[model samples]
Target: MKLRTLLIAALLAMPAAVTHAAEPIEGNWKTASGATAAIAKCGGGFCITLKTGKHAGKRIGQMNGAGTDYSGSITDPETDKTYSGSGTVTGSSLRMKGCVLAVLCKSQTWTRL
Candidate 1:
């Protein structure tokens, strides 16, 4: 009976583990500019930090949302400019966009690392 209870407890914990693993955006990415970035949970949202290249160690973005889409802001480390941004995750790729006044926008596709 104890063995059966242990097995049931382990089974009950599986879904929670799967749910945590389902966050597709929480990982390292290879940016379009040949840089590496890391996205991880920070506070109530997620933070994007540069892990490699010229802008290494810079915190460049913050996003909030669930599932495949997120909205937030992105910063250009070279110019120190911030733009309204959004990100969409599709499989091992993420399409990130930044806009000025929602009119002029630029996007880049970053691949998972």
Candidate 2:
């Protein structure tokens, strides 16, 4: 009975452990444009905080979903506009893109710092 109880407790704890697992993109990275951003868990998902450049001290983007590839929206501090955003991390490189009005867009490759 004790062995069975232990197995049940382990099973119950598994989901919580997985829930707090870190995303592959979690860390500080430097964008091609020389901006530094820190990506980490936020708002039940992930948020990117601009740690350098013009947007410093801002949460410029957020990814509410999980996976190696993340999709969400980001804000442009320059224009105070929000747009569709997505990112994929490959090794120490992060490819990020954001689209404005579903027509105009921009992309950049960021290096892990």
Question: How many clashes show up in model 2?
Answer: 0
* TM-score of each model, paired residue for residue: 0.91, 0.75
- The 10 consecutive residues of candidate 2 with the worst lDDT sum are 59-68
Q: Name the 10 consecutive residues with the lowest summed lDDT in model 1.
A: 17-26
TM-score of 1: 0.91
Clashing pairs in 2: none
Best by lDDT: 1
RMSD of each: 1.6, 3.9
- Give the Å error, residue 101, model 1: 0.5
lDDT for each residue of candidate 2 in 1-113, tens digit (9 for 90 to 100):
99999999999999999998778889999977688999999878888999999889988889865566998998877888889999988889989889977788898899999
The superposed Cα distance between candidate 2 and the true structure at residue 41, in angstroms, equals 0.3
Computed on alpha carbons, the lDDT of every model, listed in order, comes to 0.95, 0.88
Model 1 C-alpha lDDT per residue in residues 1-113, reported as the tens digit of each score: 99999999999999999876746788999999999999999999999999999999999999999899999999988999999999999999999999999999999999999
Residue 8, candidate 2: alpha-carbon lDDT: 100
